[model samples]
Target chain A: MNLALHDIRHNVSRFVLTAVGIGLLLMIVLGMSGIYRGLIDDALVVVDHIGADLWVVQRGTRGPFAEISRVPANLEHRLRAVPGVASARTFVSHNVQREHLGKPLRMNVLGLAWPEDKGEWVNLIAGRPLGQPHYEMIADASLGLPLGEKLALGKDTYTVVGITRGMVASSGDGIAFLTTRDSQAVQFDQSGEAIRLERAARVQRVRVNDVGRIQPSFIERGGGPSSSIPALASPMVSAITVRLSPGVDPAAVAAIIAAWPDVSVHTRDGQEQLLAYGMIDKARRQLGLFRVLLVVISTIIMALILYTLTLDKIHDIAMLKLMGARNTMIAGLILQQALLLGALGFGIAWYVGGFVFPKFPRRVLITPDDLWGLAGVVVLISVLSSLLGIWKAMRVEPNTVLS
Target chain B: MNPPPDNTPAIEVFALTKTYGSGNTEVVAMKDVSLRVAKGEVIALLGPSGAGKSTLLTAMGLINPPTSGRITIGGRPVLDGPKPLVDLRAFRRHHLGFVFQKANLIPFLNAVQNVQVALEINDVPARAARRRALELLDYLGVADRANNLPSALSGGQQQRVSVARALANDPNLILADEPTAALDSHRGRQVMELFRKVAHERGAGVIVVTHDQRSLDVFDRTLEMEDGQLKSSQKPD
Candidate 1:
């Protein structure tokens, strides 16, 4: 029989308890890596779903998701005018949090023109698509918004028309789709009280600067005294998503759009790169640190356990040495036990993670490659951890047995 | 048991000495201790608590390096002063056997496995090791308890298992320190007589350290120690 296994068999409960502790630590390491993957997946979901050949945004901006990007809503017409441009859709997006039955829920609200076949609504699991332009919304099923239910946003209440899966923002927020017009109203419409206050503030500004007051037309040009301030007007879109005709090169189309000094353009691959490197990079770093911390903790815990266990068997080690077992043999015994602990722990963690991660609130993606990679890391840790115990065991003088 | 081919003594220690600590704290545990044991002889080491009997035994076992000594076992020089002339661990595994005060059979292994491991370490195949282990256990009269762990055996039975393990490699010399100190007088004398039987029948030399003088009759010769030095030899009444 293997000496290490025989020793562990003699104290089954202690060995099992130590393995359980290491297993729980391994679970966290796996969970941290899974969270990083889930973050990346969630970040790219909208970009992948849009299926746009190119994204056209305001000059000097990354995109609607990574930075503030705005282009004239009418820019879609000009984009369609270009050769090889199959279609262009005006898209607006921003973050929003609303209450449902007293519980707060966050969503990535997207405003877009409908009837585009660019992979939009492709993952709908329930209800009908948004048939009309106003007061209708398609929500991700993760938002837990039931179809046919009314959800309030700003001044208007929108009825849920569809529910889809896997449509989440990089931050794990659900995505909600609405007609551009309704979204504009929700985003730009001012409440009556705010409008009244803003008009008073403007009047105060006109009176203080009396030069415009001397000419009634100049004042009228600005707006009549009680006239509502012409309502803050600007570009209505966060970006323009363009689909190219088949056989059209996205780089060629993007270059043509880039010549518009007022706008910047990116092909689909560029947007994906921007999402990966620009948007989700911070989350990856945090999760990477978390994984590193878990691994370091696991190493220390295993070392402590092995060292203590070795100490418990000090006399046995001395006897073995006295009986002519070489330093290599005794060290081998300790190293073998350490490795067994890691292997058993990994087995438990992998099996439990398979069942537990899916039930987590946020997506936890444990890939096959991750399992193989982590298993290698565990083996390395086992070897390194065994060193402390082996050193101690080797130092035990065989003469101690005589004492 | 077959007799060994050579006529050389099983153990020869020349002026062995062991001292602990340094300078102000220096105290000698053994001083210029010399001894020899021929094949098939059973010798008893009798001493007081601080008489350096253990130091001498440990030095002969090749575990405790002496301050100034030369040790030869089975006609091969094994140690010079505090340094080993050969790989001491390998030499011990191949040519020497040891039994301690406490049976000291590894608690995890059963009686048979305990003996098997000793042989296995000497490059014996596992199947052959097991068969030899069973035979040793039978020779030591513990064959029925071969599968029992050390914890399950009585003190005398455990010592018998330990003796079986010591003989597993057919070593030229066996050194046992207080092998029966924990047993009652009857069991102690039984263990002492067993050592005599092991020495004569197997043609191996045996030296046992003990405080029980009642069992001295079992040894072919007796050596006593006092004040870190050997006294005159004596024969049992």
Candidate 2:
């Protein structure tokens, strides 16, 4: 007669309430899994979208995301001149927090090598890609920057020409794209006071040196502009991204560049691996630990609940036993109830997670594999948890019904 | 209805003894108990609290094995001195029925389902078992409460359902341990009369243990137990 279902039907309110409590706990576990997946996805999103064949960073550095990397801007020209190199672009990225609409806005400012690559690969949902790269910017929708909105930073004011969706950096901050020079201007930006102090110090150095007296033009130009000076080198880039021509092997080109004294070269897959394992490994482990702990806690709670339920029906169990019910029949009652509880809880988690995940500050991506894996875990937990109740039931003596 | 011949015994227990503990803490709950009940006979086991009536009843019910004895039901030996002659559980499922003091219905199941489960335990097909359950409920005059859970029924109505469940498998022997303990005098007499009707109509041997002397007239014979022994047996006047 399906005694387990019959019992639940008799006490439906309590069963449903208990399932809801368990469902919420399961939701947190599911959310942890989703957040862990999201972390890896967020870390690799830019690397995948850039579609570079090779990355050339500063020598002896993992950069540009895992550590600091700075190569001269002219490295792009040098990379383009190499055999089998289809195209090369200077890559620059740095995080910036600026005030907009009386609130702090944080973003990863990424430089697009303009006139050659204008962020046409970005998943733009509104407006167009960077048409005029100087003062035009493509901002992610997460930054709350609408198309055509103007944002002032450093000495330049940029108008948002396009808005992208779900384009976040490894740190979970939205990205804003600008031309290489503008991004460099933002990266090395200094306050007027700091600039004046730096220029004065340069003039003083020139005055105190014997070479400055011999060459008066050096002192005069030192106060004019840092860029115009012959002694000062050009601004540096974070890395140089390279695209290889058809039938060209990236390893051969990378091996050639690896011998260079001033730069370290990496294939695209190598860069992605470094970013995933080297950057977000610890966070992934932490989330995995939390998920395991939660599953354990869930199993314990379900065990106690099933045990108490069996205790409540101890008399009924005795009567059934005296009536010659086999051990399997009684055990099936508890086991089926546990399975039903787990099934109900999982259904609730999946339904409610749909509404709750998108609202999280960071991306919560529940993949099909994660769903199937959690379902398997829940079934295993239900079976393990029902053991306590079944043990108690099997020990009930039929003579107790007489007493 | 015609009564079966005395030669046809539904159950026979020989020299049954049950004890608990050992040495200094040894306690005899029942000793050297022997009895025989014929088909179509309704008898009562009357005694005070702790008088070994329930001990003997449980032994006869095959739930608690005796320290020593032979128990045969429906002319087949089922237990000998705690050693089982056949599969005891299967024997109980097919050959015996029991009604406890409080009706002891599985609270979750409705009246008919409670009865249907007994037949199902004996491997009866569900559809036929349900039909038999409803027929038994109707015979006990509780068919209208077939869909009602135990809690929803009155005490008297629940007992009727319990009796209906006992008859579901058409068992040869039915045992009752103070089956009317929770009912009023009138309702208790009604339950006792229903047991008599079940015995006479179905030819099942019925043994009811009770402390109520008012329902003595409903049984054809009565046995009294005291200090773990059968002290007397008499046919009711």
Candidate 3:
């Protein structure tokens, strides 16, 4: 015969209606938090799968994520020569969007040199890894690309050699693998008209300058503006990923590379920090703001509901006071109702999030830790919201019944 | 009215005075009002509007304390001159009950649960409280409506349920403010008669403040008030 249970039994519909209202609000709260967690997970999946101990990028850049980092492809040779460095690979990556089967698909294309042993970076769910260069590609299954599907990037078309699962960028874009030469051509190749104009400009400048008594035949024999370009010298790569020898500390090897004036070095932890805190900072903050706003809205709604309920029961409160029920008892009645609503709402939201969040276009990772944390917040909000009702109930004068 | 064979009164108020505001705005709601009632006595307090009848009822119920008074209930002195001599809330819960002008039955609870809550608030076990609530409802002739909410009952039935609630703790005194004000004459007399039966059979003293004089015959004795002063009591023929 506790007053809270008794009252709720008497007004079962109202209690249930209020619980459901708060439940939907809680669902949004849980959903936003899960999306933030999912964003972090999506960002780290590629980094985790790469399994490299250290990343070597251009000087004064954070990494491939924060800014454009271009290091000479030849740096891989110099990196392999460092003590405790087992292997180094030239890795190039870029964001690309193209129409695939009439739908615009965003992908993060990753290019690596062959025989680098980095082909194991992707977990193949179907078909084999990328064995041939240039025309074969491995794509994440999230792109809905089946094995043997041909996709065109820029001017080159490649067949999907393998389908991997759960390989996506921080923005939830599917990942694709390309050969080094093909990716560079897709990224840096200029249009025919622009290349012709540049070539004519180079030849005209050479003929006008006439340095070293060069002849027109000499320039034409040198292959018509091709020899002047540094094609055979060295190619540019996004970054050099380094693997350390066994029993060697990555920080020690990274320190040795940091001394190179032409390049900057990042340990595995530093790159992860760049991805989590720097690359995704804005999106996380936006989601964080939304989460806070939802929580505030929920608290205000609960408080208003409890306050209105207390107002509606003012007469009953005075009667209880007249019946020799203390202020503490009335306060307990309101507080208990609030906590009950909070518990029920959290339960509903947790269940609903588990059931429906997977259908969202973006990954929404609702973890057990998030549930516990959100439950704690809901309880705290319930207790604080009940304060308004408790105040109203306590202030009700028993003398009002006599008047 | 005196107790049968027992000298101690269920309620005793000596020189009770209650005032509102102070200085130039001072209004005395009760002026030197004094009275006593013994166990099993059912008394009616009749007065016109602003005659301080409600003020005296509220003071006796331990809700609004008198500015100056010595009050005793169930042989225990609970208040002394504007200050409490004991825990007022506990003393009230243990010894007193009240019914208001409206049935004032908690609208959310059914008739039986409404009565049961009173005993539960006083720390009575739930099962025993339910049983006692049923007994009180039966005694008040509203047991048939025990499971119905207050809104489903008529005015007289609600008052009867409220009376049953007032008796839930086996209190020594029951104070009701215009319990029959909302009922028709026939239903009003029935509710008044219920108070009489409750007092005579349960051995609890009852005081009802009302303006309805048509049901006066049900009281063992009736007291009148005018200008915050008590008049001599009238006894039934």
Candidate 4:
């Protein structure tokens, strides 16, 4: 270390130039590692944020989070029957974009059961949670919409009653929650009027063409089981999120649930892997390739620089050997210089890499473990780089002194 | 030289031979050479190009290790029957100093650093090594160039740094292979005089292999090597 440090001091400019080149390459390695991590995080953001223990979806499907999952609404009742099962709820999520206060905001609208379910999916960052079964909405806080603002969804205009924080989906889009009935209506509200009248006529046994009369008979006024509102078409849900009690064996429970032909249940771990393996798998491989290429280029550059440095000192080395210096001593001198250069490059990369990230719109997270891992990598690279110089120095014959 | 030294010499070799290749194609570089130089004296080894002067110097330097014969330094047998009795590299480090044809200062290190690195290799403390290097540079009268890199110094100044480096280890014998071959006459004579002063004042046995006959007066004795054997040109005073 001492000899390497002295050599760097002897030729500061040459070493600093090599270090800068290595530092830039290292920044790319660190960035790729961070970007790879970010991609996985982004892909699983919704699953991770939903705080679900197990996700139930259609059979032969990895869904709700990774795929489109659908089951009959009564499937929740069946899931509750499983041993050690707590409660089950259904939600439907879809991407929506709208103008709020004159700026476009993209969002995911989740149809949730109200009263007992409002607090489960949405936590109020401001104002209040959903209080009404219809006509009230809670938006994501990042949407920047204030309470009492109105949002238009399909054919209905709903009032924003509250704001929720950190309710983003796997795509990093914020979410808004509405009542299950309202959600169902928004999802199908744009259907043909003739079809709606036909659906209503089938339920009421009257050829009523008026929208007002249909709502009075079917949507609003019916309290008795014999009322005129047509039953929802399949009234099926998008998917379900399940939370197991502590110490519950989730895999065992998932297996028991998967036995039903109409359902597929996945543990949280399985779902996370499915999302990474199925969705972000190719991206991780690309980043690995990028990291490997960067390292190869850096090694080539390091070898060239050290080789040049040794070539410049061949005569001096021959003289030293003739002066009775050992071959190991000369080798040590060159190797030490390479290690010192690597240390300098690592320091520069940490500084520049730390400062330059975060300005990127995508997250670039560098963990403490990640930085330490890279430090070890740099040390190994330095050792390998020294080989070129050592070989050159050792090949210098003492007869070169007489020459 | 010195009346054929009746006592055992500091450096001695007998019938030393070095041959490259064999059979149908062979080169007898140095054949049947014998010589001796005792302690605390200066000898000038003179020869023409390709006359095997360097081959003889390298053998005596213990680098090529003569194909056959015996060599001893400091009254202890170094080579016995073509096999070296002592570790050549360790023996070289602790007992010999060498000057080359060129100044050959390490380009990166300044003058004093070039000298101090020798002491450092032998595990001297940094402060003591620095002090010793500075003292040698001062004694060689190039102390002003102590902080200058070899590139900044002239040929004479660079050689002076090399000399300081050679003396830093304080070996018992010094070998100068064409040390003044690259310098002007004035610088060449001054370097030879410096070698003469070093041998006389420091009691180090110095042998300078040179082709420059102009600097013969600086040697206490002069000898000529032709066909790989030495004969006295001037008797020691």
Task: Please tell me which predicted candidate would have the highest TM-score against the true structure.
Answer: 2
Q: Which stretch of 10 consecutive residues in model 3 chain B shows the poorest summed lDDT?
A: B1-10
Pairs clashing in candidate 4?
Answer: none
- Alpha carbon lDDT at A37, candidate 2: 90
Q: Tens digit of lDDT per residue, candidate 4, span B60-155?
A: 787777788888788778986458899777788777888877887877788999899877766678899999999999999999989998889999
lDDT of 2 by residue, B1-237 (tens): 556435578899999999999999999999999999998899999988889998899889999889999999999999999898888888888889999889999999999999999998888888999999999999999999999999899999999999998888888999999999899999999999999999988889999999999999999899999999999999999
Give the TM-score comparing model 2 with the true structure, all chains together.
0.98
RMSD of each: 3.6, 1.2, 2.6, 5.5
- Native-to-model Cα distance after best TM-score fit, residue A204 in candidate 4, in Å: 19
User: Model 4, DockQ value?
Assistant: 0.40
Ranking by lDDT: 2, 1, 3, 4
iRMS, model 3 (angstroms): 1.5
Taking the tens digit of each residue's C-alpha lDDT, what string does model 2 give over A20-113?
Answer: 9889989999999999999988888999999999999999999798889999988989999899999999999999999999999999999999
Ranking according to DockQ, highest score first: 2, 3, 1, 4
- Say which prediction, candidate 2 or candidate 3, comes out ahead on lDDT: 2
The better candidate by TM-score, 2 or 4, is 2
Worst 10-residue lDDT window, candidate 1 chain A: A220-229
Candidates in order, TM-scores: namely 0.91, 0.98, 0.94, 0.83
DockQ of each: 0.65, 0.83, 0.68, 0.40
Worst 10 residues of 2 chain A by lDDT: A222-231
TM-score ranking of the models: 2, 3, 1, 4
Question: What are the runs in model 2 whose C-alpha is more than 4 Å off?
Answer: none
Clash count of each predicted structure? 0, 0, 0, 0
- Give a tens-digit lDDT track for model 1, residues A1-403: 4789999999999999899889989998999989888988888888888888999998999888788887888899999999999999998888887778999988888776865532245478988778887888989988999999899888899999889888888879888888787777777767778866766666666666876578554444344323333444554699999999999988888889999999999888888888887798987898999899889999999999999989988888988777788787899899999999999999989988889998888888888888998999899999999999999998899877766
Per-model C-alpha lDDT, please?
A: 0.87, 0.92, 0.86, 0.77
